[model samples]
Target: MKDTPRFAPDDRPSGGWGSLKAVAVSMFREEAPISTAHALLKQNKPGGFACVSCAWAKPAKPHAAEFCENGAKATAWELTDKRLPARFFETHTVSELQTWSDHDLEAGGRLTVPLRWDAGLDRYVEVSWEEAFAAIGAELRALQAEQAESVVFYASGRASLETSYMYQLLARLYGNNNLPDSSNMCHESTSVGLKQSLGVPVGTVTLDDFEHCDAVFFFGQNPGVNSPRMLHQLQDARRRGVPIVSFNPLRERGLVSFANPQSPLEMLTPAQTAISTQYLQVKNGGDIAAITGLCKWLIEGDDAALQSGARRLLDAAFIAEHTQGFEDFAAFVRRTEWAEIERESGLDRASLESAAATFAAAKSVICVYGMGLTQHRKGVLNVQMLTNLLLLGGHIGREGAGICPVRGHSNVQGQRTVGITEKPELAPLDRLAELYGFEPPRKKGLNTVEACEGVLDGSVRAFIGLGGNFVRAVPDTQRIEAAWQKLRLTVHIATKLNHSHLLPGEVSYLLPCLGRIEIDRQAGGAQTVSVEDSTGFMHASDGVAEPAEDTLRSEAAIVASIAQATLAPNPKVPWSQWVGDYALVRDAIEATWPEIFGDFNRRFRAPGGFQRPIPARHREWKTDSGKAHFATPADLRTDPDTPEPDADTLRLMTVRSDDQFNTTVYSLDDRFRGIYGTRMVLLMNAADIARLGLAEGAIVTAETAVNDGFHRAVAGLRVTTYDIPAGCAAGYFPECNPLMPLAHHAEGSKVPAAKAIPIRLRATKPA
Candidate 1:
């Protein structure tokens, strides 16, 4: 059976089927009208159809779903016809819904009407928008005596720029930057790391760069699950003889063989194109050691050509001018012995040598990474190490060679570009002050981790979520659930019901809004909303379909109403005017963020959204020395949360099945990896299974021992051995979310350590 490889290596986290095939047969089936809308979504026109999944930008050309398969699932869920009416609210109390699984609650579909629970009735009865808004307004009014920071405004990447901008503006005008955004969960490291290293917290490459790369190195990320559209780029690179090197704990489906539904021949013949040319299975929490080893070999080892490669590799010129603390960093890399690297990374010397040789051979190598590398003890340093590698290759400021952080939200980068960040430096804040004629808050706001902590401490009384499902995105969900309950009120302005929405506050409100596919027909003929893509390119998203309901408002319109009721109106720009014409809001954005936003709309009329100036794109590194210097080295001790070095205590990583993306669950079935009707199955190596005293399909319980003596029992987990390294095991997120404690976040970025959790396994109690 091992020689035959019955499961095709079964390296992908779970599911192997095409994300689209899964979405097409699942989400799209639930709503066929959306199939037509997806085609229009790809057109680079100014309407509201951007991806609802990770922030990897939508393509200039519209496809069936300008989004990926996971995106379709997210959009379908957002645009789902099914509704949770008074009957659903009647049958399921807030407490009951709280007990529902993340999948079941979100899959229950859109919550059309507002709901508020009454203790007398014990059920959430439908409430009018006026009453709901009025109640929320009253609650905020009650907090007038308290400092504004007491109320937290959580932003989602899925929110329209208009909504996000207005939301940020309202928070600032209201006198607190308590903006806890989705960035805190995923790419905070990219933002913090890049800003510290390069003075700008955005990606250095564009979609155009994908075509130019001779080789693309992906680590700790599965584009098939997180950003599957990236598969097209990887697939094309395969045709061009461009090698894609993938380093992750598990082999990914997109990195293995992907049959693009977009390709005619592939669809006809079901021919699968090969992706990752070299697959490196670095163990969980092993990225630091793996990356450091690559640096060591390339710099000092017998593969001395890499030094010349490093000459072409190192932006030495950029380093000399723009960086500091490198001599120390260099010394640190030298001290890291190959033996230590091999043992820690769980990679044989041959494999490491092969990988180093591949990098040496490639002329222009683009190193792309995701959360796995960024949500650890040394996440910030890990990112800098990537730049250091690129810098060593002199890859920056060149086409097809740079560092890319594949963000998950559709407009997450855009949100930051338009000043949605909690940590705004003096320059952006001054710009906002100059453009808006008001002093924007200069104080930094709480990241997602701190925001949750505030909730736990009772300092934050309210949580106003603009879009994302916060609870699932946060680590240590038990702590999050308990903390969120302490809030005086929680108002979620969302398109669908998520698990976070069900984590009830004393008083809660769920407001349904129009999705990107749905046209926001108002006094205007057609309305257009702006969205930023991965590369900091902002484009207009205009909805082609009518609003799902007359009662449902655009996110902008919803925010405007809340603004009108909640705060005293400011005169710089009328909130009502901005809502009526999103262009007015864009004008404000242009004024606030100049140089880049100059001629924003006109520039977008050309190709692939408007391009933001990456200082490095012009060889203008925004680093202090005006060059691209590597970051100061950090001492990344092993994760304190890592289990004791014992046979039973193993490091666990959370991953996505091919059928799902981010927080949204597409289906229980993962066809490609052969998982069916469950998310709790553990993927361990066959050897590890024997070592751990387990058998095939034996149900196990994951017990997480953390502070407060917390114990989370993940029951009915069928142990399925896969081609994984000996010490690492894998499971899906939000399901295993209970295993991660709130304190396990990276200290520098506070990004949740979802990819690495120290855990133990045991047999589940017999049913």
Candidate 2:
């Protein structure tokens, strides 16, 4: 190992010299500082493209340097000078590459051309784009012939709006709605919860709202590594004396303190801005309990305040006008005892009441959360409880007050906005059929979890991944891979090589595509793609750097080509026409959602683009009762998706390293947690380690608490003592995914319970 594993308390700020050092190392590794420098200048700026790494909202009027360290790293990674030629693939066998780590595989560099798996030679052979597309089409056609439901079309967040719209259109035209996406694995819970509560699935707050907010509640998220750009906004909030409360299982460095690299004063001094005024270390799967506790406290306070004839803490007028089921919700909270709340949340009454007091004082509050809250069995319920808390303050629709589901990936929300959903809405389908002359499918399709189940049951035959490492990212790593192997064909359209590409199907095709920072040239010269940020800002992104390879196609072009190849005989839509002009795709999108995407092409070119109308943002509830609904605490039960663990079991949640984004590992070092040069380590509470009669740094095996007749074990994980809640442990995923079962997921969202897996650890022999 280059560096021995080290441990520190992570006392430093988030975006100071450490971020700069990491960015410099990444730029050096790419060996294209000049190109990367030019590209970085345009990143997240007006008249330029957005960063591919995250979906953090940018400033309306971007500063001279609006990009963050990770943004620079993401750009450099995409614009790296290294290239994988055809000869390299010929020299390396699939089995040989399988031995490489996920980082090492992608480190070999960007894919330069289309490659087809040669089963006979056990190596990938170069194939023309036309030939590869034809082969893929043939496989897809054959699968469709057997059963239209057999073919699953999957998309990742990296896909552009143009590509996502076209891909979904293609799937619907092909008589299938099997449009599974990365959202299925990430923020599906947020969508389901928010839609049920506020009648809108997207975030209600805007970038400008941050400046006016009185309080910000961050739940189950680490912005330091996941969304570094959010630190700038957070730091600004801190400076303005806004109270930021964090409810998480771990005390992440980003949420604790941050030094904005963009701030001159912060960079010049040792002083780091304190971010979280209150940090609640709620146990895994305890968010719903914690949030419910807060709600109950608020309910009690409001009731007392009403009895005294003092100013009511609750917004009585707003509740009466814009909310329903408040009486029932309040009754349930009053009936629920504090014993269960304290037992489940791992927190006492004092802390919950203190947080509630802070909420009662704040007029405008923003509640933001990430996968930590949604990757549990009660994920949807967790979110609904959060909404209930915000609703008490009449937080939705007011300035600086709303629910924000901070999504990963630059365009995951954009993918949905452009209609990349398993359940296609009737309005969009009808519009598409009227405008495009095709009968869009109405039946619900497979999600990420269901898609895997489909593969296992032989219901799904072909799998096409638009972008992302599906095999590695999904839960039950072995089972997912085995199911992929059974597929007739697997197509991966990506920039870099990863494990998913190595796990080839009977006839596999790897189609190389343009990265976000690469110029996308078609027959109509240069083209730009659009994406929506977490804040609902839809902006156009124009790539500055040259293409990694001329053979590589734009994501839009690839989807268009595939559609043309598969649906050729008098296709319903003009596939070739949209391939040459992305503006045409935008036109179709504008037509489909005229209210939301009016003048998409023209408005997208504006300074900061346009924000989608959020019904809840205007206090306009679009629910069945035309009002916001609060979930009763008693109504929520323990998530049935996760098996109840025995007394000896500990809940395990998967996290990402500071040096990585999603499944992309920049380096093995987790600088915040102070772990270095390895990904197979587990972060356990000191008490838990002692309880197991294990010493720190001891090699151990983690087995699932309950076995549902499926093999769920991840062995050889080095245990390290950390300040986590007792009986709770954390590990980085893709590595720890093997320990998670596919059947274990949130009931409503179907998102894998990655954050709350019941596990047990035992000491093992040193490697």
Candidate 3:
């Protein structure tokens, strides 16, 4: 890979020959062309495994080739034939491995057995499963006996719902609510914001809603790279003449247009379908201002219509019957100055009015968003403002309109649904007390940000990860990696070796686990685990491929074993029995959350699975007042506490490249962005580049603009001119995560504000 990226303008539509070529390259690189091809056919099929990529909902009527380009890469990456035996670790010291890139570390291959860190040798040595489990169990028990809060169990969204349930149960059974998962870092703001407004934490829109909606509004989401499968739905909606309006800082190629690789007509003719009919380049952290502008335009238009005795623009009936706080919300919008909105949003009033016209003309609309709207200081407010825009037209609970927060992981939503949260109120404590014969923890626990703080402060002594590279995913990477070594014990149950594995604790163990694509067999026959999609659809995923290694254990089995070893002689939990038959785990889940998972085993077996009930979908608000409430933003500024940038300062947002998933870089190239061979690059507007006296391709350094007393910066980043807001910049995540301070996060959700970090660039001489 080159130190500097090769740049070119990629005008080709997303997901055509480029996508097919990328998929082929991924398969070839993994050296499993035939097996990967077979896996692709089975992906997202009714009887096949779910794609271990984005949580985009699978269509009710499945297509022959349901998986997308990135999905294929994820599957091939998982099913790679490469193996990392004990000898490989023996040859590499921990210090030596720490110098490797994240991609190089994970690409080394699947872990073949349990390994324990040998402090004396400064390397990892193979250990028996029994010994590893016993040691981990003893360490956890010791921690629990000392202080349950001293230990933290972190889970990734990749874990199955069954496994997640057992993992959370294990934590609660040990008498601590310190159960933080991947959602805390991504969509916790959505969960927090939507719950307060719509009274439901999950999205209200169903897959079928796309077909009925007249217009689709996209805010800060790039589906083509993040959730490629969604392009099919967008393409279908576009073909049906639905107008799509997008508001994002970057004019993402996926939102501009897409070509379906599966469509013979498109692939053969190289034809493309337009995605966003209107694109508004909102400034970073300006989503709230933009959304508030829309609401203001609509509300004022309705007032003028009433004066002229024209048809009412707002939904008077819905507001009166099913909502509260409308008068206050309307007053707030009416009083908000248009000039402030324009300046902050980086959009003229005409664009917002035009967007409002499109939105008001449509009988129904769907508002879709991603982390861009939910990873700010006021991320919750940003989401609530979008909800406010949807509420003006009575979009919520309608057949064709609602809010959709596109989740990243395959089962991140499911992990939260199955009780993998730090909040005690979200868990079914009453049922757990009755079933397990023990009082569950009632105190709130640490989230991702707080967990990092605990580790840094030496309050957290042990760390257990079910599946994820925690150290690579979190902010303040250098600090967290160093603090992680101070832990008394660290156990990672994973399918492959990642950077997090190299950051060993005092008594660290790496337990190899089965990937979702691989069959999970137990004392019973082959078992199936369920996952919930972004749309709250619960479906079973049957692993069609064989395990990479025979000694690997299922995540459920590993969690069960850990629980059994830690809390033995407790008959009520039945950890061994549940692990033997996953159906037993489902039974416990059903009994615990009967309202959502009622008839779990039976419903999971049904074709296409069942949709979990979303009360807001039926106008049944679950708020304190039992009515949907419009939330008034404290101010138009999304980051009220953040100081305004000077002439050289810019709001920098960390993003995922086309060739990468969360913290998992498949390659150094970001094809869609026209970046190749390097991840160390900064995307800046041409205007800003000239204003800062920096030329395109010039080496520069981005320093945090905040006065946090800590000098945070990333150097050796090549500047690339792009069509972005003048005062905003873009860079890939994990690399840019270092610029984000641990103290900078959403006020309520605690999600790191990676989307809008205040930064200033300085020219650097090339080495």
Best by lDDT: 3
lDDT of 3 by residue, 1-767 (tens): 44655898798899999999999999998888888999899999888998899999987678889999999999999999889999998789999998998888888778999999999999999999999999989998888889999989999998999999999989999988898988999999999999999889999999999989999999989998999989988999999999999999998999999999988999999589999999999999999889988888889999999999998889989999988999999998899999999999999999999999999999999999999999999999888888988888899989989999999989999999989999999998998899989988999988999999999999999999988999989998878977899999999998888899888999999999999999888888899999999999999999999999899999998898898789857788888888889999999999988989999998986767899999999999999999988998778776766678899799999999999999899988899999988899999999998898888789998999888677888999999988899899999999999899898899789999999999998898642
Residue pairs whose backbone atoms clash in candidate 3: none
Which candidate model has the greater TM-score, 1 or 3? 3
Candidate number that wins on lDDT, 1 or 2: 2
TM for every model, in the order presented, reads: 0.93, 0.98, 0.99
Residue-wise lDDT of candidate 2 within 572-644, one digit each (tens)? 5888888888898899899889899998989998888899988788888889989999876554445564556
- Which is better, 1 or 3, measured by lDDT? 3
Cα error, residue 31 of model 1, in Å, equals: 3.6
Instruction: Give one clash count per candidate, in the order shown.
Output: 28, 0, 0
Per-residue alpha-carbon lDDT of model 1 for 1-767, expressed as tens digits?
A: 11211223344322234544566676554564454455335534434456566777656665544556676666666666667767888777777777776677776766677777675666777889889888888888777557777888888777777778888887777667887787888888888788777667888888888888898899888887787777877788899999888898886676677877776777667467788888999988888778777777766652354545534434456556556666776788788777888888888777877787688677678888998888786677778788777776667778888788988777777777666767756237776676667887777887788888888888888888888888887777777787777788889888777778776678888888888767787555577777777777777666755555677877888888787788875677588888887778878877877687897656654446777888876667676666666664544354765445577777888877766767777666666566766777889998988887788878889977554566766777788878788888888887888888788887588888877787888876331
Candidate 3's error at 332, in angstroms? 1.3
- Residue 600, candidate 2: alpha-carbon lDDT: 91
C-alpha lDDT of candidate 1 relative to the true structure: 0.74
- Between candidates 1 and 2, the TM-score winner: 2
What's the residue-level lDDT of 136 in candidate 3? 89
